[model samples]
Target: MALRPAPVGTGIVFTRIDQGNALLPAAYDLVSETRLGTTLRNGDGVGLAAVEHLMAALWGCEIDNLFVDIDGPEVPAMDGSAAPFVFLMECAGVVEQGASRQAVRVCRSVEVIDGDKRIALTPADDFSVDLLIDFDNPMIARQSSCFHGGSFAFKTEISRARTFGFENEVAALHAAGFALGGSLENAVVVGEDRVLNEGGLRYDNEFVRHKTLDCVGDLYLAGAPLLAHVDAHCSGHGLNNAVLRALFASDRNWKLEPVMSALPSWSETAVAAEA
Candidate 1:
């Protein structure tokens, strides 16, 4: 996939180069599937999957507009984290747009509940995420984390956490036509009593940290950076999209407002993209 600078208001659009240049806007309403990963489809039924990592990187980089040119069905699951994407963006450099950035400020709390899983967005002065997860596996019984969003914080704290899966479920996922390219290099594989990766994990609570990364990416589907706090428990791609839908269901729930603060120092520099 190639990332190209876009004029203001272009938002983040995906061009399906293999499918007649179909345009898929990364918006919550267009989210068609959320089984294992989030998928967005255009009117012509062209869909793209696993976009959460790259989207999270874009949010971490404070990028407002870009065109993603991809010739595949999903974004490259590079090491199953947003770190690679963040590195590429830094190498390419980010440019501050002429206009102020807009944000979806949550005016009231909105939530989605499915059994014990729950996700919510509520008013906040700045973007942040508080998440919790639970599993019966001894390796990951329960983990919780809070992230105060910013470029440096995201890169150092959340971006390198790799997506994880269970060793026993690999065959079933494969049979279901998912994780076709997933492996130890791009995902953390949990065995009966231990992690199957060579070096163990990047963070002690890496699993929950990775979930926060996915949350940032999934929430970016609001078409802007959020000026709110996200609270999620036992949530996944499905509930993430559902919460966004619920947040926009009422005009009183949120307001689109311009961000008045100055751009962060990291984005102040302008650099040339390599050939």
Candidate 2:
């Protein structure tokens, strides 16, 4: 896969090189599935999977426009964290297009409830996330995290948190065509009573941190930076997408706000090459 620069207002687009260069805009309305991870499909039925991590990295890096060229159905699961992608962006370098940035500002709260799980977005001056997760496994009984958006905060606090799974669910997940590429090298494996990874958790609350990372990625599908406070509990990819749908259900829920400057860590003007 390659990350290429896009013209201003291009947003984030995934180009399926292997599928005749089918263009799939990374937008919430195009989301086709969220069983194991997020998937976006075009009108041709061409689809891409596991885009959450990469999307999160783009959001964290403040990459407003880019073209992702890939040859497979899923993004590479490098370390199962957004950290690698962040590094790639740093290596590729970010340049601000000569255009003002735009954001989706929530005008009111929108919520989705499913049993004990729920997610909501409310008006805020900046993007932030408050997320919590609960699992039956004692190793991850309950974990909570909050993120106030910025490249530094995401890279240092959220990007290194790797995806995790339960040992017992491997077979079922495999049968369901999920996590076919998952392994100890790419994901944290929780065994009967402990983390099976050699180094254990990156952070004491890494599980929740990773979930927040995923939330950041999932929410970026809104097509612009969000100026809102996201509150979620036991939310996964599906619920994240559902909340986005709810947020855009009415014109009264959000408005686009234009910022006259570029994000920090980037020049106010320049051009970027494909990386």
On residues 1-275, what C-alpha lDDT tens digit does candidate 2 reach at each position?
Answer: 99888888888999999999999999999999998889999999999999999999988888888889999999999999999998878877788777777889999999999999999999998889999999989999998988985778999999999999888887678888876865788999998899989989999999999999999999999998888999999999999999999999999999987864444443222126555
Per lDDT, the best of the predicted structures is 2
Candidate 1 has a TM-score of 0.94
RMSD of each: 2.1, 2.1
Candidate 2 colliding pairs, count: 0
Model 1 misses residue 96 by how many Å? 0.9
TM-score on alpha carbons, each prediction: 0.94, 0.94
| Model 2 stretches with alpha carbons more than 4 Å out | 171-182, 260-271
Error of 2 at 251 (Å): 0.5
Error of 2 at 47 (Å): 0.4
- Clash totals in order: 0, 0
lDDT scores of the candidates, listed in order? 0.88, 0.89
